[model samples]
Target: MNFFKPVAAVALGAALSASTAITAFAADTTLVISSWAPPTHGMNAKMWPKLTKMIEEATEGRVTAEIKYKLAPPPAQFDLIQDGAADLTWIFHGYNPGRFVATQLIELPGYQGSAEAASVAYWRAYEKYLKSANEHRGVKLVALHTHGPGQLHSSTKVTELDQIKGMKLRLGGGVSGAVGDALGATGIRVPAPKVYETLASNAADGVMMPMEGKKGFKLTEVAQHSYVMPGGFYRGSFALIMNQEKFESLSKADQDALMTVFGEPASRMAGQVWDEIDAIGVEATESTADNSLNTASEADRKAYDAIAAPIIEAAIKAATDKGVDAKAAVEFIASDMAAN
Candidate 1:
């Protein structure tokens, strides 16, 4: 019996060691990233690449990611990931409308900041306040971010605040639609990819998008004019998310390492790409002869301030009704940007 006891203990120890090795090897290390943006878009070209490298380094080769296009349309990305059709993806909150109201807090006009600041602040706000809403329940929220200020890109030059009235502007949803309604512009609903064709075919007068559209969506070719407001008409909010079950399947050690590179750090990475691309888009539009860029005059800005008041109130009401402290979130975002 004594000899059997030592033999049994040795066998148990060896089996436990083998089990640990198998568990380490069983972690699903490679993530499939589903993307809806154009292949050349910064979200693909710059943002995804940096994030992939971060995953690789932090996981010490235990995990990796790859980008796949056309897995689903922009709006369906969340469901696609949730259903395990894809392992990871980014979502535009505006595209889903009723399904995502809390995200609109970042979309409200006049948040004075760069994309990076807003993105960082957004993550903080999500953790502190937005999480209670449970807006992103199925997917594991990795980061929250925003694009550069959205402006009017049109076939005709628009400089004054009132010039936007009666223009057939392609509204990309969220607060941009609210801004269009406020300006009394006819809203033509379309996806970002369709904006070029919408303008080229004269189906719409212009589009509400960030300066990056000049390069990313080739707006300079169709929409020769850019009407920029003091703080932008509105900003668009986005989220980087992963399939929850997929995330949970990873080894605890690998999961811990991945967490270190997620959230605010990841948001800043994606937002910085937006800022860089916006600068490039600005240069690209100005460098082209036929393209025109116009900034609202001081009087026009004051008029815009007046126009924005009601829209702001509606946005706050919408958010507050959903149990978010819209005023506090807005003020926090502004202060975060100022601090940065």
Candidate 2:
């Protein structure tokens, strides 16, 4: 009878273990992510995949997310998340223009750093300063990040900055629009997915984008020449946001674990992905027959500095009106980038 009891206890323990495993599996929830970028883009391929893994691991399989492409357009992502049509998504602050004045604080030119550093800075500054602006109201913000420095890409070689004066360039909204105006280029506004066609059709002579465009947007195939300044013409601000209701639906433990993995950790991961893709893009451009990357002359850089002063002042005034200490935030971002 004692021997029979021992065997029954062992069988009972095994059954309990299996039941627990089943319960855990049943508790797992998949969050849908809306992505507008090409499936192969760094954000989709690297950033989201890594973030999803982090979520699954941190939540112990309690929660996860998968990217669903073409679920909505880039500009519509925020609303999609807000309405719970998608549980999570990323948005370019620039694409919405004046709607997010504080976000432009990171988009300003002449920031010295890699996307990783800038992104880390962007998140800290957003948390410490821009969060009060309430710019991203409907969604639960997960992280803030910026792309690498924006540079010029053209079909025709531009040896001198002045050579771009009359050319038509595709500006990716935000400060890129201002930079294009400063350079006296006619601005052609289009979503990023349309950039290659804009160049191919001769509708735009160039585009202002980060180094990743060489591959991400396949610009090296259409625009063969690149001109970059010391700091950068502009930076694109982006945010990973989740539906507020969806976030609130999580188990408290899962919510707390997700909170830890997001913010700076998520931002830095995304920034690293941008830096990686930029390196890949540069290598791809190097292999292309006529593609080249050129550093602007010091004289041109100085000229750009002069042109930027007014835009910077204008941005500060706008942010100040929004009750943000824009100057201090800019300084903080610079310092944060430097420190990290």
Candidate 3:
């Protein structure tokens, strides 16, 4: 009986040890995601949680994510992920100008119509044309998505190109600034967080951003006019990336699960969310009688396109210098957009 009791005690201890090990493994598998968008933005409200839930469900809860918001400013998001301050982050490619020259192909005017189409096209292009994963060395990119068309929101009515001449406008990043300059508007570089303050203080006459800005920044109260331009003049790309070390640390099963849900499918879902949010923004802007929305004239669009063409040419040249096949990439993107 004494020998039997010792054997039973050992078995019980082993069972408890196995249970503890399983629990530790479960706890360590949680993913940490950080984003600059507040909890209410479409990305935070509709997309991030949806993706996280999908990831968890796909892995049978073996993989989960804890999403933290506003961990840093929008521009610092990419670097934050690179340094492991965050396991994953959404990076606005335009925020880090010149760093993502190859990927900037998606930002050019007249290339995309719908977010869903563009998202898939961008992923396909990255795989087919830009084989240089070296650009994303040290980080694992999950998806590349872009916002809807950009429009002008101004304190004063801007119905034509001449109306914007000599006007100081708040621009998001380098491409926006370049577009603004090309259009003969004085482009003032201001971070998204500071746009409202600058607009209120008379430092800027207008801002060029997605329709979502009206809701995100409360532009309706400050800006009375929204000018829609032709040919999708301004759009920016966003990247969902994971830290290299964090990605490598995942077990093979977990990595496969993430890959199953992350790439084109995840991007398509996120892009649809942006499309829905963009419609909401337009509705919100139009709801107020104090605000006016107008589309640019054909002549105005033609004038702007003439200016933008050279910028696009220069961008292609810049990409060529960076070892990207500039002409082929441009032709590929254009043909893809045309086909889609």
Candidate 4:
């Protein structure tokens, strides 16, 4: 009987240890999400959390992600994901210059809708037309999105379209850089994180970005003069990417579940976050003293429309050169966004 008691005690201890190990195994993977934005930014505070939650739920809590800040610079995000330095990251197509040409299609001005509509259309366009380019060859492209209407934010008030000429403005590249050139502004290349410092130092007179910048980047403190253009001057293109090898390492079941949450669903979710933060930015701008909200006059709007026409045509030609039906893609996006 005493020998039996010893055997039973040993079995009980083994069971308890196994249970502990099983609990640890439930949280098997922690994806490192390398982000360059400030923690307070909507991208960091809301968008990443939402994405992580989706991933966790899809995989039944088997896979989770944690945000890691400043692991690399903004322009290096794509390479980071490709090199597997990080499991996931978001990238601005404009930041890498010639690395992404097809993405400029979404950045072209005059898309009439919220970021959510445009982003959903963007995902569809990527699957139908843009995927052929193979621009994102090494990394797994999870989602594509664009910010709300990009407009002019300045230190000094700019009332007319012509006033932009010769002013030094921070341009995030791609079509925004082209827009700056079209407006005769001396384009200053800087990442969004540097925008506040650039404007505060007077190195840049203004920046072209979404209204979210007011709250997201503290632009309300530096660039108080807002020259709002109807339909916005441009839109910024962004992509969520994951390390290909890391994604492949997941169980087939988990991988398939994650795919269900990726692409259009994730893109729409990101765009909705942008819309929410953009509203916050607008509220911050209006509430702050000495901040001026100047909408573009009818004549100025007409002038901008004329200026944007050639830029749009030029972008189409660029995509066409890459073996894509650029015109059809753009038209589809427009119709889809309008309907959305």
Give the Cα lDDT of each candidate.
Answer: 0.89, 0.89, 0.80, 0.95
- Greater-lDDT candidate between 1 and 3: 1
Question: What residue pairs clash in candidate 1, if any at all?
Answer: none
Tell me the tens digit of each residue's lDDT in model 3 across 1-340: 3798889899999999998878645744777899776677788888888888778777777877888977888888888888999888788877777777877777777675677677777777777766563577778888888888888999898888778778899887756767888778888876777788899999999999888888877788887799998656678778889998988888888889889987888888878888888888888899988898899898988887887898888777877788878768767766766676
Top candidate by TM-score: 4
The lowest-lDDT stretch of 10 consecutive residues in candidate 4 is 19-28
Q: Give the Å shift of residue 309 in candidate 4.
A: 0.8
Which residue pairs of candidate 3 clash?
none
Off by over 4 Å in 3: 1-28
The local lDDT score (0 to 100) that residue 164 gets in candidate 3 is 79
Is candidate 2 or 4 superior in TM-score?
Answer: 4
TM-score of each candidate? Answer: 0.91, 0.92, 0.88, 0.93
Candidate 1: RMSD to truth: 9.3
Q: Compute the lDDT of residue 110 as modeled in candidate 1.
A: 78
